[model samples]
Target: MASAMNSLIPAFTFILALVTRMEKLDLKVQSSQAKSIGTILSITGAYIVVFYQGPPILFSRPLPNLHSFSVSLQSNWIVGGFLLATSSFLISLLYIVQTWIIKDYPAEMVVTLFGCIFVTILSAIVALIVERDPNAWTLKPDVELITIVYSAVFMVSIRSVIYAWVCRIKGPVFVSTFRPLGMAFAVFMGVTFLKDTLHIGSVIGAVTIALGLYAVMWGKANEVQIIEENVISRVDSSSDKVPLLQNKSMEV
Candidate 1:
């Protein structure tokens, strides 16, 4: 499951970049080079996660041990893959829902109240249904609960509201660059909080991913420049033609 999440993180990032229009590698851009770079980055990230992270976890201690190949095939990988896929689907759905709902509403209020209400209800339902000990839900210290609440509020509510307003004012390239910044944050957090040993392969992988993201952004900026240049060129040509027409009219 952890390995699956590692793969999904990059996939989610790519999806978010497209949906937010931060990078354009589509047919309208007519740039095969841009599309190829995006594909390479995505595939490389997926391959890294699958080869480096997936196998270790799949064969490790936490997962249930199956005595036979048939049992392992039936019980473990298939179910784990399905859950990971479902998680990706749900994250996409959440983004879509939040985008739609906040389109007409004040982003802050919409994110805060709506998110809080939904999470509270959902958590309560889950606690009732699945928590073997109902009191386990209430056993957390007030400080811990407050911290969780604040983090949730900030992540889903405050940050999202800010992002929407930022998107409106700054445009896509600015927003997209923050993704690499986020990857940097992940590296920092892993080193600090988790005390995870930084491997050479990990550093190389991060650098590769960062470079790929930058290439996609570079392509977008190039496309934008081309569009502006074309518009300016047409305007200049039209202006020059008008003066020639005026000169001919005077001669006539």
Candidate 2:
């Protein structure tokens, strides 16, 4: 469910980019229309994933203990969904801010470092407040420790730097367009490692999100191509004017 919400980041980023005037939208343009449709598809897919959980498809054998937590998941579904949506919104906002910073500073690593530091501090504060059990905070020499180290290094550190660099080069909307790609990995991992039931709605939602992402990518690519062509045309026209101006000055 969280992953489903996360897939909406591209749409959120697109809207934010538009709001910030970093992106232009003309409904008469095919590319802009594609982008708008893509955003709507992504949103529709997310809602389907949240509201409609069709019959579970057999993916893998569930662990014997799987049923124990099903009730808890159902109970907290609304709250978790709300939090996930909020997190997605905040992530989109962060991408916009990161792009703004990178535009001026052009420092990916430095931006990522500061971002990770503040995020860590904020996470720690939240953890301390929510986690009442001291044992939950303790890191043991086991899978938990390994997971923490891996997430800290790869997910937080490396990924942050990569995202920052990409944002600097391609802009945040372009960077965020890949968010739906993670849905495939999330579904695979959940079914394989977690032995979770695969729902038909989830599969449909994931496919819909992927299609929307592709549409958005195609639209963005076309827009870039058009902009480049316009730039080249302007340069050619300006160069032609340059010779005329020079000839006029020489005659004078």
Which one wins on lDDT? 2
Structural similarity to truth (TM-score) of each candidate = 0.60, 0.83
lDDT values of the candidates?
A: 0.56, 0.82
**What's the CA error at residue 190 for candidate 1, in Å?**
3.0
For candidate 1, the per-residue lDDT at 143 reads 89
Clashes of 1: 0
Q: For residue 149, give model 2's deviation from the true position in Å.
A: 0.3
| RMSD of model 2 against the true structure | 3.1
For model 1 the local lDDT of residue 113 reads 71
Task: Locate the minimum summed-lDDT window of 10 residues in model 2.
Answer: 66-75
Q: Which 10 consecutive residues of model 1 have the lowest summed lDDT?
A: 54-63
Question: Per-residue lDDT of 1-252 in model 1, one digit per residue for the tens?
Answer: 544344454346446656765445466564436644654564464445334532121111322343335433445777777887777656544544455455556465656576768787998888788878856767476888988788877876777667556444433333433443454457556656655445444455466666666665676567767888999999988877657778899999
lDDT of 2 by residue, 1-252 (tens): 776688778778988999998888999998888777777776666656667779988667778776675443346778888999899999999999999999899988899889888988999999999999998877789998999899999998999999999888778887887776666557768888888878998788778877777777788888989999999999989877657778899999
| TM-score of model 1 (CA atoms) | 0.60
Cand. 2 TM to true fold: 0.83
Deviation of model 1 at 136, angstroms: 2.0
